[model samples]
Target chain A: MSTTTPPRPRRSRAERYRSALWLLTKRDLRVRYSTSALGYFWSILDPLVMSGIYWFVFVVVLDKGGDIGEKPYIVFLIAALLPWMWFTGTISDSTRAFLREAKLVRSTSIPRTIWVARLVLSKGLEFLASIPVLIIFAVIFGAQANWNLVWTYPLAIILQAILVLGLGLIVAPLVVFFRDLERAVKLILRFLFYASPIVYSTLDIPAAIQPWAALNPLTGIFALYRSGLYPEQLMVFPIVMSAVISVLVLGIGLLVFRRYERAVLKEI
Target chain B: MTEPIISVTDLGIHFRRNKARRRSFKDLFAGSARRSRPGEFWAFRNLSFDVAPGEAIGVVGRNGQGKSTLLKLVAGVILPDEGRVRVNAGVAPLIEITGGFVSDLSVRDNVYLTAGLHGMTKAEVAARFDEIIAFAEIEDFVDTPYKHLSSGMKVRIAFSVIAQLDEPVILVDEVLAVGDKAFREKCYGRIDELLSAGRTLFFVSHNERDLRRFCSRGIYLDKGKLVLDGPIADVLDRYNADYNNPTP
Candidate 1:
């Protein structure tokens, strides 16, 4: 007897979005902590350890203290590090995200955007896991808290996520073509670490170069994150500009990624 | 017979090659150097085919003959350099069984990930979770990391997820050759079920037994061109005839 199946309709956009996001998130969370003793603890601990080292270097060794009006250096550093970690981790991992899934890319006909989005979303969750520590650090440092901080912090995360997603969309596909892009991203992240106002304040830059620093999308995100932890010392203009730039970057990145979507599978 | 679910026309894919002759230090100093041969290759050229819904088609060709490439194109994993491929329904390519599975994740997690990659929802996967594990027969290893599982186990889990996808069109590319006899038989059974459900299947395999058993129609590709398209038995007869008596 002949066993035959009828052609099923393609999934709608909403169904695709829901399925893709859930699967990616579950895979990321489970796989990341799999076969490890620490498991979920590592996500929380990774940033804590890094923050500790930076706090020691900047607070003790450098012995540099600047109120920046209200917030302490340690508080500022932790706030900056949280989002910076998310940005760096997302970009670095995303460079090889598609290539690592070469098996999937070459096999299935699922949308490529789903893969890139999964990496960004997973990193975003990891970023969220580091928040309690941020709060604990803030309370220990005697930083003032305000409701505005809540609004600003999430905004910062949203903006940074947009920027990272855009950058990832561009980088993930390119890395498939030029395998060296993976290495290139690592070098670029190191350079970006210093260029961004992560360890040092953007205020530290000379007046002549402050405008250029203001132009960086990350600078706005970092500023907003800091403001969220300490609202009184917030800078409004750059934060707004950063939000605008993040949206623009994300939009352009998605366009480029979708344009080259078909080519990526073939090349890989 | 229904209208073709997949249609391809004037498809071509070209690969560029840099044929610049390698010049030594001595050649660099000397102005007289011959140009190298042009480097260009076509993986597929002007290929076209139409596949009806619920039809089982077999793609047979020698290595590097663009059989896989053509499959990839029809699956929409890649686009053609020229021409077009149009599919009226969902296309699931079974080229790699373990596509987005993370070794660090459990077999349970990998199943969900695989289902997700094929565009199934969490609730949907959850509903079929028991059935999938039962089919794979890895209930004990469901919580274990995929990296810890044997290759055969991995294949089983991967196959189970794809088998449950319920996609309209399924593309199988020599993946069934990896498992043990029992497991292979189980997979064949699943394929039989899918076929009975009237699902469209496109398979690429060198196994004559499988080709004759599962496929109703066959297309013989040689050097990226369609050399034969007819009933499965007739195509196999011609293929065997050519194999036994190759042309000089």
Candidate 2:
């Protein structure tokens, strides 16, 4: 039942997971970039193209562009849209995190949570890399930097990271057990694209609907992001709501992940 | 008589068929009742064993007889259905030849990454990097992407990385099949070196001669049951007789 010999000191669970998380994250980043010729350029290109299309269609073609505010509609759209791309991209990819590396999951004894964490970390790195693009747009649009911008950016980044971790933790294991969750997750994210305030500001919604819309954690997150670009439109309600909801989702996601972690290997 | 470095009590593992999974869109939308339940079957059942330090164990069985399952249970990759497996020492599992290799990463990168996953620190992997590459004899291709390597080169790289891992127990499942004759000889030499250094080994091989070469004791499993367990010669004799003269 026990060893009389002096065993090598075992690393704590947190330490082991931390190391594995780092290595896997590195591997994911290297593999992703090495496959394509353009490499990291592809990360910025996705949001740039997407924002350009939305800007042209909404501002040039549709009448909604004039209502966005003093800043160019492109600037406003990039501020909100870049973070949305990161949040949605991380969540969707993480749904297949475990399933993608079925052999690695079955072969290694590293904590299974590292798979989902790798996806989050790698995508987060991409999101961070894309921030310079956002800053360039803001400078061109003549948006003035303020003291509030410094804290708000990190705050939004940390909150969105936490929210993605929690959701990914839940989705990664759940999709392994229920394969259809992979498809269902994509569908839900597509619907959520319109549901969140990605294109237009949340203020444009009716006052009756604004409170209901604020219930979405992303509404608060996007509000935080948008507030950085257009401080005049900043609302504290969504930021506070996002903070509360992120913690709740993190707690629930951890519970779901732990419950299903052991069962996942057998199912896969 | 000594305490086992690895012990299994009432160990069992069962797998459910894919039919039991809610894989269809209709199944998710319509709920659980519409999906057919997958039948469950045990891979191994009611098995118990204890492996002493420095013992080399040969796990022999026919295909689909849970030979690999037992190794997986010991390595802690899969959970046992009803019972426990307690490993009191570090384990290195060679279940897949390219288990953790990223195709786009260079061989040098994979060596560090794979070694780190097995609990080696960055400094440790760096110290042994040259030794692993030399042992694998692919130092020329160390900077090449893993996908670019031929299948044989990949195996050599993977085996070299794992061979340098300093674990108390090593679980090998038929990785010898991948290597060339020269590499297999190197692997045999490595096994001899490991045994001499007092490492515990559990080798699962279908080749009887390969098992006899490395193992002093043999465990024969038949249809998830412990058919025989004893000295290598006796267990092999019984196994060979059973196979040569089948019961109707």
Whole-model lDDT values for every prediction:
0.78, 0.82
Task: For model 2, state the Cα shift of residue B171 in Å.
Answer: 0.5
In model 2, what is chain B's TM-score?
Answer: 0.90
TM-score of chain B of 1: 0.87
Worst 10 residues of 1 chain B by lDDT: B28-37
Give a tens-digit lDDT track for model 2, residues B1-248.
88999998998777665546454535434543312345667777888888999999999777888999899888888877678999988888888858788887889998999989988889878878898998988889989988999999888988877777868898999988877898999888887877777889999997888788889889888877888889987887888787774323
Docking class of 2: acceptable
Which candidate has the top score in lDDT? 2
How high is each candidate's TM-score? 0.86, 0.89
Off by over 4 Å in 2: A1-10, A232-234, B1-3, B17-38, B227-229, B238-248
lDDT of 2 by residue, A175-258 (tens): 876777888999999999989988878888888998888899999888888776677657888889989999888998898787
Q: Pick the candidate with the highest TM-score.
A: 2
In Å, residue B32's CA in model 2 sits off its true spot by 13
